[model samples]
Target: MLWLRSIIYYFLTALIALAISAIAGTVWGVAFALCVVSIACLFHIFNLHRLHRWLENPQVDNVPGSFMLWQEVFDQIYAEVRKQKKAKERLAGTLDRFLSAAEALPDGVVILDDNDRIEWCNPASCEHLSLNRKLDMGQPITHLLRYPSLRDYLKQQDFSHPVIIRITRPAEQTLSAQIVPFDSTRKLLLSRDITQLERVQTVHRDFVANVSHELRTPLTVVGGFIETMIDMPSSDAATRETHLQLMYEQTQRMQRLVEDLLTLSKLESGAQVREEEVDIPQLMQLLRTEANGLSQGRHTVEIGRLDRPRLIGNHDELHSALGNLVSNAIRYTPPGGTITIGWEKRDDTACFTCRDTGIGIAPEHIPRLTERFYRVDRGRSRNTGGTGLGLAIVKHILHRHQAQMIITSDLGKGSEFAVKFPQARVIE
Candidate 1:
C-alpha cells in the first residue's frame, strides 16, 4: 500500500507540473490533456484515503466515526462482558455453598491431591485432627493422620477396600474412621463416636459369662444328686423317699431355669415388639389368676385400686412380664406374706407396679438382678425354685418397648418393680 501511494504521489506531482507547463505554452490539446490527468490524480488520492479508512487501521485514529454505524457489534461485546461477570459470581457462590456444607457436617472430611498432600478440610476434620494450615497445608496425609492403617493403605494402593481406623482425639472422644476413595484422586475420611456401642458389647459379654457360670453350678448339683441316687441300693425304701424328694426339687429347679431362659430368649428376640394394644387392667387380672394357681390358695394377693389402665403392648407378653414379678413375690413372701399389684399412670406414661411384701432385694444386688441368671442369694433362690432370668426378661421386654423399668427395694420391707411406657408410644 505504501509503494502504491508513493507511485501515485510521484505521478500526481509530474502531471501537475506538466499541466502548468502546457498552460504556460498555450497549447490547447496538450493543456486540456494535462488538466484531465491532474484532475484524475487528485481523485485517486481521495479514493486512497477512503480505502485506508475502511480497512480499520487502528493506527489511524482512536475515535473513529464508526461507533454509530457499528452499534450492534458494540452491544454484543457489552452483553458478553456482563454474561462473563455474572458467570464468575455464580461460580463463586456455588463454591461458597459447597464449603459451607462441608463445614456443617458432623463427620470429618479431608481432600487430598494426587501427591497425597492435604488440600482442603472442613471444620470437623480440623477439630478432630488438629490440622494446622501452616504446618499441614501441602503436607503429607501421613503426617496428619499418624495411623498405621492409613500408612499401609496408602502403601498398598488398594482403594477398593477402605481402611477403617479407630481414632481417639481431644476431649476424650472415640471415633471410628473410614477412608473412602471417591471421584478425584483423593481420600475421604468419615468418623462416628462408637463408645456406647462398645460399652454395650462389653456388658453383653459379661452377662453371658455370668449366666454360664451361674447355670454351671446348678447343673453340677443335679448331676451329683443323680449319681448318688444311682449308687444307692434300690431296696432301701427310707433312703429312696428322701433322695426322690431331693431329685424332684432339683428337677423343678431345672425346669424353672429352662422356662426362664426360654422367656428371656423370646423377649430378646422381639417376636412381639410390633405395635399392639394391651388392656392393662385385663393383663393384671390374668397375672393375678396365674399367681393364684402358683400359690394354691397359700398367699393372699392385695391388689391396689385397679384403674382400667389401657396401654399399647402385647397382652400375653406383658402378662408374662408382670407374671414373673408377681410369682416371685408369692414364692419369696412366706405363705402368709401379702403381695400387691398396682396399676397407675405417671407423667405421659402408664406404669404397672408390682409391690410384694416379701424378702426384698439388697441395694448392692438390685443393680445386677436384671442380669441374666444373676441371683442375689444362690441357695435361697434355688430353694424358692427361682431361675434368676425373671428380672432379665423383664428388662429386655421393657427395652424392646422403649419403656423404663424401676426396681425399688429395702432389706426386710418389700420390693416394687414398675414398667413405665411413654404415652406417645401407646397404640389404640
Candidate 2:
C-alpha cells in the first residue's frame, strides 16, 4: 500500500512540472525551464535534511513529561495505553467495592470459576463451612468442601430450591444454603446460619408437648372430683368442706400456671413495655414493709442505703418482679434467717440484690431455673404454693429491660439473686 501511494505521488508531480515547463519553453527558453526544475530539487533536499536530523537525535522523541506523539506509530501506541489505563482504573474500583461488601455480609459467600474451582471465599464461609480459604482457593469445590449432601445438590445443578445442612464437623451449626449459577459458567454459593431459629422452634415444640401433658393430669383430677361430687347426693357438710377447699386450691394452681404462661408468651413475642423512672429507695422501703407484714415476726429484715440507685422500667412489672423475689425470699427463709435488700452502682450499672438465708438451690438445677415450669424440688415447690415461674418471669423482665441476672447458691448457705440493671435503663 505504501509503495503504490508513493509511485502515484511521483507521477502526478512529474506531469504538473512537464506542463509548466512546456508552457515556459514556448514563452521563455530551455535555460529558464532548467532553472525552475533545479530550484524545486533544492527545496526537496532541504526538507529531507530536517527529517533525517530528527531521526538521528534521540532527544527529539522526548516531549514535556512524556514521549512525543508527533509520529503516527507513537500516537497509536499512546492512545492504546490511555485506553488500557482507564479500563484498569474502572476495574480496580469495581473490584474494591465488591470485596468490601462481601466482607461485610453476615452470611457465608463462595465464588466458583467456570471450571468449578474455588475462586474466592468470605470470612463467614471459612468459619461456618470449615474450609481454609488459603489452602482451598484454586482447588476443586467438591474436593475441599467434602459434604455429601452439598455434592449431590450441586451435581443436580438445581437452584430452584435451597438445601439446608445441619453442619456438625468441628462444631454444630445450621445453614440454609443456595447456589446461584451465572451464564452457565460461574456460580455463587451463599449460606446463612439458622441455628438459633431452629433451636427456638425445637424449644417451642417441646414446650407445647410438655405443657399439654402436664395439664392433662391436673385436668383429669379436677374432672373426676367434680363427677364424684355430682354423684354424691349434693354432699354432707364434712365432705362438702373437704371437696370445696381442695377444688379451690387446684383452681388457684391453674390460675397461677395460666398467668405465668401468658407472661412468658408476652415477653417472648416482643411485647411493648411501659418504662418509668423507678425510685430505688421508695421501692426498697415498700418491699421491706411488705416483707415485715408477711413475715409475722418470723424473719429479721435489714435494709441498706442501696447507693440510692435509680432504674427505669415499667413500675407495675417491676413491682411484680420485685415482689416475687421478696416473697420467695421470705417463704424460703427459716424463722430467724436474715433477709437484706440493697442496691449498689457498679461501673455503669445499678445492681439490685436480694440476699437471703433461705433454702438454697442445687448446682445442677441452676441452669434450667429460667426454664418455664422447671423445678429443683417439685414437691417442695407445690407445698409452698410456688408456681415454678418466678425466676422465669424475672429472667424475661431483665431481658426486656436489657439487664442481667446472677444466681449464686451453696447447697446449704442460702442463695443470693443479684439482678443487674443496665445503665440504659437507669435514671440516675
lDDT of 1 by residue, 1-428 (tens): 44566567667766766666666764654665667678766766655565466446432233223232234433444466567778988999999998999889888888777777888877777766667755688898776766677677777776665455566654454556666777777767665556678768877897688667666776787787678877865637877777778767766767777777777777667574555767777777778888888898988886796766587666666776788889888887877777889888666777778887788888988888887667777788767777778878878777777789898998888888887888876533
Error of 2 at 286 (Å): 3.5
> What's the TM-score of every candidate structure?
0.57, 0.71
Give me the overall lDDT of model 2: 0.78
Which candidate achieves the best TM-score against the true structure? 2
- Residue-by-residue lDDT tens digits, candidate 2, 1-428: 44465566556666666676687653444455556568656755654565455446524234112121224444554466667778988999999999999988999999988877889999998876778978999988888665788878878878899888887767788888889886668999888999999999987897787577556756776787788888996688898778778878777877877888898778779878778788878888899999998888899988864687678888877877877888888888888998898888889898888889987888998888888777777777767777777878888887777878888987777988888887887776
Instruction: Give candidate 1 regions above 4 Å deviation.
Output: 1-192, 233-235, 272-286, 292-300, 309-313, 331-336, 344-350, 358-371, 374-383, 398-404, 410-412, 420-428
Q: Following a full C-alpha superposition, what root-mean-square deviation does model 2 have from the true structure?
A: 7.1
RMSD for each model, in Å, please?
A: 10.1, 7.1
Clash number by candidate, in order: 0, 0
Give residue 343's error in model 1 in angstroms: 3.0
